[model samples]
Target: MAGDSVRDDELAWLDATEQAELVRGGELTPSELAEAAIERIERTNGALNAVVTPLFEKAVAQAASAQLPAGPFRGVPMLLKDMVCHSAGDPLHGGMRVLRDHGWTEPEDSHLAARFRAAGFVFCGKTNMPELATSVTTEPLAHGATRNPWDPSRSPGGSSGGSAAAVAAGMTPVAHGNDMAGSIRVPASCCGLVGLKPTRARTSLGPGHGEYWGPVAHEHVLTRSVRDSAAVLDTIRGMAPGDPYTAPPPSRPYREEIGLDPGALRVGLRTAVPGAAGQPHQDCVAAVDEAARLLESLGHHVEPSAAAVLDSPAILEGFSAVFGTIVAWEVDRWSQRIGRRIDLGELEPMNARTAEVGRSAPATQWLSGLHTWQQWAREAAALWEQELDVLVTPTLATPPWQLGELAPTALAPAELAAAVGEKIAFTVPFNITGQPAISLPLHRNPDGLPIGVQFVAAYGREDVLIRLAAQLEQAAPWSMARPPVSA
Candidate 1:
């Protein structure tokens, strides 16, 4: 094994798997890798503002200690989204000025945070997010907008935009993100990275709670390589004792599924979402058309299919009801946890209106909304069971927008909600049904910004998605691509 140290400049683009291999092969020490990452963070964070809180000294101390575990991602540097993935005593501001001002801190590691540590990831810092992670763009009054590395004038998609931009810019190989609406895949689409939202309960959300935002959320990572994503899933996928949900066990490790051919499959392709948000840009639809052709070449039967539920007023209304009520509950929960009232000054108008709608709505209304979505879930999942082995679509209605195009701070409540709904139409439906979905950067626009192709599998069918993603990645590789402001 070579004992030579790799230069920091040379380390910028290596993914987590490659970095870990270098450490195990004696080419680099954990301390050296951590320092290189810190230097990269210092070098580029000023440009992107992706990282909200730097824990460089703490990461260095941990990496240099003898107590570091020997796990799959040994020595790999990581950043956590400043939401529920909290570490004891760490500042987990959730991109809210109130929390940052009052010095809110997590008492201990949430279950997922502990899992990241057990996987041998060294946490360097917390990434920026929208206020309460409610916005689809990462601009918050607490911390200014986290700019896209491809074009700083545009967004990196949110609320996981910070993690997506940091990983795409080479500040870290992998960073934590969770999908409630389209948080994970939206940012992945905008930032030119791979993001997978595992089947609900495929990962434990505990030491915090059984689930977040009901079943509309799942925790995972954003990565440059499909293999890295698969490997990370292998390392952290498990059920906690008290978890409210449990995914069916995989036949084998997710990493083992990579490179293995996913036999001829049935693929349903849809280019535009229905309803008010139905006007998809030509560039976005073009990306999906490109993916359909590529899949056809790979021998998968690709056919046009629409998710009819997405067009239903009942479904849309139910989505808004569930979303509003959940937001209200969370606002009350977080504020009460700190023994304070919901400060309007600290909350964005869009989110404040959501909470008000929830609080003011009759109890029957909230129950009816929950019941409506349950029915919608069954109807949506039936499309997959009766027909599709996989569904392919453009990840967004448009490419990453200019930074203020959907500003949470300036828009009226209804307008803001509609704006978010428009951008996230396709991705949100999968979240509603607890299915596994992944965003792969398959094409670039005429001006050279990335556009993602999203593949969604039936519930608990991540194995199918991972296998297909690996296959697509190999057939039309995007690994060599880099953003202009990358490390």
Candidate 2:
């Protein structure tokens, strides 16, 4: 087979779908593709700090080996976020300084990792993230902050910031990223990519734990194309044997939904997060306005909305008990596995105190908070069934903030909840509701920072999102909007 002579600069611009097709068509060998990615990572990672643990040798060996699986993404390179994603026998620091200090490695592959391998993905490296994934900005003390490819001085939304950066900069076309609250979509917004927080139980987070934050957290990917997101989701979405919950199965593979007509759908436009946290920045508000116009242009009905569930202080109170306690649990579990006690001093101040507050909170309060979030989820989901088919809002209240500005370490757990919750205001409510939400990079501020517009669908309805996202993506393409500090 004759391979196409893909130049390094030209190769950097292709999305995963294009890259995989080129490989399949004998225009790019898997080995050549892998080497190009490694070289790109080496060239760009120093400035981006996106890939913390380079698996260059491993990726090269796997790429050249004949023992590769015949999966859809075969020959395409990817990165895993430094969190629940694990590759057996590889360093797996989840952006935690304590684990990094100990040189911890995962003993086995997470189910997701196994599926990724099965899909013909070459594991390139692990990306940087915030400490304990507690912050939206990826300024991890362990690996340092992952700078936005859009603007190095600004933050890439975290804790998947590293993955987003790498993907944005063309170091990798797609990367693994999980959402506890807004980890996936926030960074997608900041980095100008497609980030989908799948429905609760849509994908497995197995062997480690069944649920997180009373089931708000989810695992997914960050990619430049809607079709890439859909294809990856098709490859990875399923119920593992021991999963506690199972999202209703899609009628067919989600990839098929990419170009499908979404019909005349009712869309709710929420420009600002309601309540004391205040309006989204003017850029963010304008993004919503712009997205509404775009959706209407596409023949969808758009109407004004106020996210009532997020407006209440109850969200912070209810979120605190579950978030704090689960964090404490994960830390203790990891400590036991490593056979070492976590010195409070070793953890970032906010995370250390977060665990402390979690430990002190009553078990009853944790249970109560779980119930509250579920209720909030129901109320939020009701909008779709009653008045709208999708809800659109600014992914973050504002565009990317400068590094170190949002990680307020001095605050108490409740105070931190108010602060952190406000930053992820639009995305978290859907996490609470177990609905599928997506952040589309549809608009850019005057400063050229991307302002992602979020569209949330009812529980287990990512097909609707994929169809709508594909339409929106075609309306306003962002693939050519590469950051200045790119591969």
Candidate 3:
């Protein structure tokens, strides 16, 4: 069989499941898959700047190794967002210019990275992200911008923007993404991919640090298919030794949930942006309305309802305090790790301002913020307990905006925060409540940009989200929707 003869575009669209099947069936070797992905990245990344650090030689070598793990996704190529999860001996800058200048590399694989390796994924490279994964836009001074494949002028959404761009452009079948404030789902919304932020601690952050961003952060992948997301979760979801906490175990493997009946669910639809008087962009509102109608068609009951606590003033106040402190901690943590203090002048303006706030804050304020989040979470969770099985909303307040629209270097600290707050309005609340939320590419505007609608379930209810997402994926197949710039 001529495995090497596979067309680049054909390989580009093949999800991890299909790619792994080829390797398993002897139709393609892992080396061939790695080479194909590398060719695509090199060919397309010039425009996208998605894969910032190509690991071509390493990927090829790993693919050819007899010792490669024979797990579910063996031979599939993947990109790691250059934040949180680190691979041994690879540069892990977290989109910081200072770390990039210092030439930092991790000494060991993060538990998540190890799981990816064990699942038989070949690492194509590290993708771009905002500084410290702080901003919703991926235009870091360290690595520049990661452009959307659908529209080069626009952003792909960030912290995981590069990963989302790569997957959307068909440069890779899947890519790692972590979410603290919609980093995963926002990018998925922007890039027209499947982004799932599993319940907090669903995947461990261990051996280096326990909790990131005070438990608001969660890790997962952006994929073109719902099954891919579920399968990947099955591969990586578990607890590691010495972890601060872990999510409740799924009754069955997440992949099993893909085709299972979700049973007619009671879904709440909210088109309005919580706490904001104005509605989301017309396109975003339409996206939710369309998704709600689709859900109804699938035998689910859809109603206009949402957690009232989402509008609480304390939401922003608490999040701001905790976020600021995390920024300060990140700066100090990196300084201690690299054996040098990161001067404020070296940091981005927004982050510098945030760090200052964190430093100036009294310890009681931080604790008070945590208390507010805790109480708010309980209040928000009550909606699921009494009323709805799922809540549907626009993943982002608007469609993908132009690059530099929210650049930290260009905007004032308050200006940047306000802009970012708009994008994160719907998605951030779940991150706070530790619930599983997914963004699905269900609509595209007249301009041809994809608009994603989000469906969130109670904490540790990824199984429910998976079933619904897979049903939607089948109902409105997006696999054939190629971007203008793609592999």
Candidate 4:
């Protein structure tokens, strides 16, 4: 098929699976797909500022190369978030001005990047992210801000905001994203995509470090379809050599889980922000209510319930302790790698303050914080063990807010923490428990912005999530819901 026959919007909306099928069937060469994506990025990225580093020439060459792997997603174009998962010879700034100023490029591909390449994804570019992936918004000093495609005034959510924005705006069918404190899911929620944070260690963090930000961080992708997410996971999910730990391997390929019936499930619904004084926005609450009803109609047992331990304020204290220390360690690690100390002034104010807190925290306090989290996780797991198969909540407390509203530069440390706490209230608990969670775009507010609902499964139970998410996807299809600023 000739490229001129297909509308650019049609090609932009095709998921990776569909794009791969066309390439495999010889209807379109990989070069056509790559070039089409590049054109879309060139046309759309200026408004969204999603792709920070375009590799169009390299992508076109790779797509046309005979060496391109013939894996499931062969010939598909995708964007990598410029954090955690690095691509060889590509600029890996981690959204920091210091790294960009130093002109640092990753010498080798991360294990995850290799898996993506093996699966036949052409890396068109790296997406923008918050500095050091510290803030929940993608307004890094290095890359400016990535505007939401849904509404330019609002945020796309971060540190995976650029990835989410790119996918939503149709620059790419899918993009890599990592979640520490709702980075992937929040962005997915904001951008109207599927964002899955697989169980801890499901995807390796290797040849560099074992775990990122303790056990709370996990890497995956934001895609327009549940099956795309499942297919991508099947390709990248595994342990690397000398890894710290690994999630339980799926009984079969995760792709097989799609369309499989998720028999009658006992789902608990929660709309209140745990440990916070107020409930989420009315729109968010309504989203959960609608999702619960939809689940009930689909033969799942949905009830108004939540784990009691979620209300404990102590959870925040423990999370803060671990989070702060990790930031400090990250600063130190980068300093050693760059062969110079990273002055506090070089970091964003929020991270600089967090580093200070982390540096001052005694080892005993850090350990105590870990112990506290472990204790709470054990307690929280009881809800699943006794009654719930899945827990549903609003992915974020509200729909996407204005871009600068949550900027660390505009708020004091405590103010920023409180604001971030509200946004991540429902998503972070599962991160601590090392369970699988996914954000689905099930609702949209009056303003036409997406409001996502999160579903949590027991530890290492991504199969459960995939099945249910697929079922929900079918029940309320969202693939055709395009944003205002899109390809």
| 2 or 3, greater by lDDT | 3
Give all candidate RMSDs, comma-separated. Answer: 1.7, 1.8, 1.1, 1.2
The deviation in Å at residue 172 for candidate 2 is 0.7
Candidates, ranked, lDDT: 3, 4, 1, 2
Better of 2 and 3 by TM-score: 3
Relative to the unseen true structure, what is the C-alpha lDDT of residue 338 in candidate 3, on a scale of 0 to 100? 98
TM-score of 3: 0.99
* lDDT, candidate 1, at 362: 77
RMSD of 3: 1.1
lDDT of 3 by residue, 1-487 (tens): 1175577668889999999988899889998899888988999999999998899999999999999999999999999999889999999999999999999999999999999999999999999999999899999999999999999999999889999999999988999999998999999999999999999999999878788889798999999999999999999999999998899999999999978889999999888888888789999999999998899999999899956778988789898778888899999999999998999889899999889889888888888999999889999999999999999989998999999899877789878978888889999899889999999999999999999999999988999999999999999899999999998
Candidate 1 local lDDT, residue 108 = 96
- Compare candidates 1 and 3 on TM-score and give the better one: 3
Model 3 lDDT vs. the true structure? Answer: 0.92
Query: Which lDDT tens digits does candidate 4 get at residues 1-487?
Result: 2266566679999899998988888888889999889999999999999999999889999999999999999999999999888999989999889999998999999999999999999999999999888878899888899999999999999889999999999999999999988899999999999999999899999868788787788989999999999999999999999789899899999999999999999999888888877789999999999998899999998888956778986689788778788889989999999999999999888888889989999988788888889899998888889989999989999889998998868799768867777778888888889889999999999999999999999988999999999999999999999999998
State each candidate's clash count. Answer: 0, 1, 0, 0
* Regions more than 4 Å wrong, model 2: 1-4, 407-417
Query: If both were scored by lDDT, which would come out higher, candidate 1 or candidate 3?
Result: 3
Ranking by TM-score: 3, 4, 1, 2
Alpha-carbon runs more than 4 Å astray in model 1: 1-5, 277-279
Judged by whole-model lDDT over C-alpha atoms, candidate 2 comes out at 0.86
TM-score per candidate: 0.97, 0.97, 0.99, 0.98
